[model samples]
Target: MNQRPKLRSPPPSSAASSPSPPTSPNLNRDKAKTIIKMPRKSYIKPTLVLASLLTIFALYTFLFYTPPNYNNNSSNLLNLVNKFDTNNSNVNKVKIYMYDLPRRFTYGVIESYAAARGGGQVEKDALLKYPGNQHSAEWYLFSDLNRPSESRINSAVTRVMDPEDADLLYVPFFSSLSLVVNPIRSANANGPADRPTYNDEQMQEALMEWLEEQVYWKRNNGWDHVFICQDPNALYKVIDRVKNGVLLVSDFGRLGRNQASLVKDVILPYSHRINTYNGDIGVENRKSLLFFMGNRYRKEGGKIRDLLFQVLEKEMDVIIKHGTQSRESRRAATQGMHTSKFCLHPAGDTPSACRLFDAIVSLCIPVIVSDYIELPFEDVINYKNIAVFMDTTTAVKPGYLVKSLRRVSTERILELQKELKKVKRYFEYEDPNGTVKEIWRQVSSKLPLIKLMTNRDGLIRLQNSPQSCYKISLYIENLDYQEPATTYFGEKPRPAKLACTIISMS
Candidate 1:
């Protein structure tokens, strides 16, 4: 519009030579395509590389990893599992096969004893009562196994009708009762010539004859068999013959070291004869400081009873009298123990007696004076927690035991009473999860050892080699108990020594 210097267009030839004005729209479109296509190609290569690395790493981990050793840690694991199963009532039980012996071996003994006592007839199936004595564990265990499976859901042993499914073979002979009911005879005495009937020796011989004929007994050489010989003299004639089997015994007094040991045998609690004290644990009702009411004279290891009585009978607040198993005596002994703070548990004919269990059920702290005593359920029970253990040497000293009792603080006494209450149920035979189940549990624990022994009996033959000596050291945790550790001396036939020690976790 500036007045129009009407300039003619430059020549078309000159415009064509200047590269056609740069083409701006087509250049921008080409740059956009390049950006999108380049990013797509770069992403594909990196994605493939990452996936390959992940696959290789997974394969390496799957082929090369190793777990840590668990052999030494098995005890802790087993304890955890046991705690869970105990609280859940899911304990694994032993499958028992009970032999169907004739009535003369089982309830017949009970019936004969009852008839002699002028009692009414005992119904075979309805027989639940046993003589009120310490050697009644056989009766209790037999009765428990005879019950229906549904009735014993929480029992530690189940009766299997078929022997093929059995973990143990139970010979339900009333050996202890038979011994008690029959007349005593010399070791060399034969049967009575007047009557062609059975005596204890004849009954024992008959049992062995019947047992030797059984298929299972011959199959395992009786190594997997179970016999309830709770009395020290229960099966005296047949003891050596049945020594390879599992013997449920009271103590090792009458048995040789080779005949029974903690390795292959189970120590059972004597059936308590006194009434159980159901009251709370406290000292307010207790009046006496020490109580003991048993035979003052005894034999062998039991000689210590006389020595202990000489030192304790004259002490103040003490009741130490000689009593036998009678109605009035049981009542008096029950009263004495229930009111006493501590009950004396000296050695009997054996290292143990029913008095110890009686004291346990009565909630009286046991003053154990037997040096070589082997206790029942020692693996699970810490005797130091519920009882006072004194060496036989010191216990017989004139002023030692009484002075020790006076030194125990009230707090310590209460603690002991509380522990006694907690464990008393284990000594009870009537409770569902009591002595019967506990005995079965202990037997079940011996299954592994039984199998080992059974297998070794067939494999190893020791020709004139001395019996292998076992010095078992039992470490009791969380206590101050200690005994001299005895080393294994394989030269002679020495009884296996159980050495205990305290191991503090703290």
Candidate 2:
């Protein structure tokens, strides 16, 4: 190792007999006191200069160094409030208050059934293995809305804790989860001995009873309350009672005539089982003409699908496989749809199925064969641009479906596919326009009507209770220091006494 450099020392100072003229001891003492008493101001100036420089740097970073698109990425609460136009400030935000329902209604069902029924952790972990398998609608919605998002613009609503501050009351009950879990089998399927009790109905009954006890429910009788009944059969037993409430569902297939309308109830899209397809599999790479993989033996409206399958099974370039509800089936469906140009979306038990969204995700143009089908986000998206809709009679006619599909210009089909790709984000579970945001937007549209009904109900209540005594409390910040308050009115007011109290804040 190399030796270190040696250090040098300065010469010692010599003592001096008195730099200044000799003074009296008392005079020295007074001089020392005066020097010690002089104010120390040098350190403070540098400290203040440093503080000013730091403040200037901070201001520069905030006002100039920030990106021009800061608002797009900002999650600040003030930014959320400032996005709305000055004229529409009052109507921009809709405050929703969620009810504290029992676990059995939402997450309890997920924990109990989602893990076990979906194959424990193995199935959930493998969700990424296959590109197109999505969680159930109830799971998607419950998970998405549980957290707040910064990108939600048109539906920039807030969830409030206090019921009194709410524009709409949200019942966070996962109706589908409760129904799918602990499913009851039919007596006819298991021979007459197995009795079928309506579990979904019983749950709804208990839920209604619990809701009726709450003070918020008594206010407008649930007119401002919103319920999520995404599954067709969910809350079917108590449909009439909750009909007046804002009902959010995937479709109106399960509702009878006059049960649900577009004005009162919102149509939500089925959570696509597939992730978005961003591949370059244009019309050229898509060798298969049309594809449909579902149950060939379905009842009611699904019979049309069965007939089409029989007719198209032998057709060249058309893939029609018998469908089953299994992982293998889902994987096969995903692969088949990826290679096809047009995916067939026919009525099953209901006119709408998750298949349409799957096709959209796979960049396959959907050939919708349901005449009475209702699509989600129709107000925002024109379905005709992305899908080919056919009447039942026209589709069922001999060779009509294939002939009509063949008649579609290759360019037209490509256009539909491009449009399908554009709308795929809306149907995706993670997108801002997914279930939560769309549901909020739908609910926001109905707020004006809901407010009108609420005001009318209030007037009716007031009229019915003319003798009701109302007590108002006024808070004064500094009672003793402020001058006496004065009031002016054109008309005489009712005689009332005022009370005051003094309290120290500091």
Candidate 3:
């Protein structure tokens, strides 16, 4: 009878309590077991998981990945692995190896030069905004190289990164990339500027209009040509002339310079407006303030760095002595130019050394050491309005600095302040600053809605054109060592031009 008491359906839908169907039997049975298991486990699962994730992150960052402070905008452009873990990113950043500076230097040099120049050590957040000039997607700047006693800026087109595409090797600095856009197709390729080359996206577009591949080089490998900064008359008087294409000048205002017809103009106005609209190619919102302070060194130019370091050490000592500086200073004392009033430049290097831009960003007086600066054609329009240039090569004296500093009085400083106020307007709203922006604004605006070098497809497309194929190959060549200028860029580059036809099917 007990074995036959199984498998019975006892309850009816509306019947009152015919049988509870053993519902309470299960509830009663689980209560005892639930009490025992509940005490066995703690409820810190979320907290423990969070803690584990944090520890893993910390371990990975310290041992495997490097985090960066985005304060320095230029740091973003540098191909620095330690600062930026770009090893896994999808962008092409320039990796600059500084071989221009002296070896075995002072600690303050990093601060005085990098920090004082940009006004800070560079917070990682600010860098995300800047990325870099239009040349590349990312930048990794380094200071570990065999610097020369007397440094030189050598720009060479060689294959360093892509073996397939050539790159530009800027000696004393690091490596660089080229973006192809509207080809500046030239019938004759004579001068270096006229040749198929690109500094930013805009210049790339301008070059595409006139495409010519004639690589000419008495072209020794190292720093072959110096961008001599001087009056237009002196510049045109000494050399051969190429009428077809444009010249690459330093100062944007040089485009605005009033030169005699007898005198050859240093830079073209179109050149200055080109870089203005190149997006990230414009000035940084936040930057490091680097102040290059030192005695004049035209004669011994050899110990310029030594003297600079000596001066910096003394200056830093004074600051720390008065508690203004510190022995524990991790960064340059660069808050002085917080809102754009800082800059640092090389005593002698290129016409517009890093200082010119540093001062431009800080909105400080550039304090030029050499008068021979042949600023690119139209640099002055904006450069002159911003930077401070002190001719150390000619007026070498502290009194000059004193007078110049004094001249930056409430009125002159106010003038600079007025101009500095327009910095954002110039960048976003468009000013005479953008070299490429203006051109795109001018010609490209009226044309079809086609992407320029700013678009990856547009850039890659340039690599396929029969003419641009080789030029692009040269422009992209940066695997290792230096690539010859003539082979990649091509020979017979007497007259410069651009290569803008789309050839790559992919």
The candidate that wins on lDDT is 1
Indicate the residue-level lDDT of 90 in model 2: 34
The reply for model 1, stretches above 4 Å from the true place, is: 1-92, 118-128, 183-198, 460-506
In TM-score terms, candidate 1 sits at: 0.72
- Computed on alpha carbons, the lDDT of every model, listed in order, comes to 0.82, 0.72, 0.33
Which stretches of candidate 3 lie above 4 Å from their native place?
1-244, 249-290, 293-336, 339-348, 376-385, 393-395, 398-400, 403-407, 423-435, 439-506
In model 2, which range of ten residues has the least summed lDDT? Answer: 497-506
Instruction: Count residue pairs with overlapping backbones in model 2.
Output: 3
Model 1 alpha-carbon miss at residue 447, Å: 1.2
Better structure of 1 and 3 per lDDT? 1
What are the per-model C-alpha RMSD values against the true structure? 18.5, 19.7, 23.4
In order of appearance, the predictions have TM-scores of 0.72, 0.68, 0.30
Evaluated with TM-score, which candidate comes out highest? 1
Error of 2 at 172 (Å): 1.2
Q: Predicted candidate 2: what Cα RMSD to the true structure?
A: 19.7
Model 3 agreement with the true structure over 138-228: per-residue lDDT tens digits: 1211211122311211111111343123222222211122222213347884444423332333322222222122131112111111122
- The predicted structure with the larger TM-score, 1 or 2, is 1
Lowest-scoring 10 consecutive residues by lDDT in candidate 3? 216-225
Better of 1 and 2 by lDDT: 1
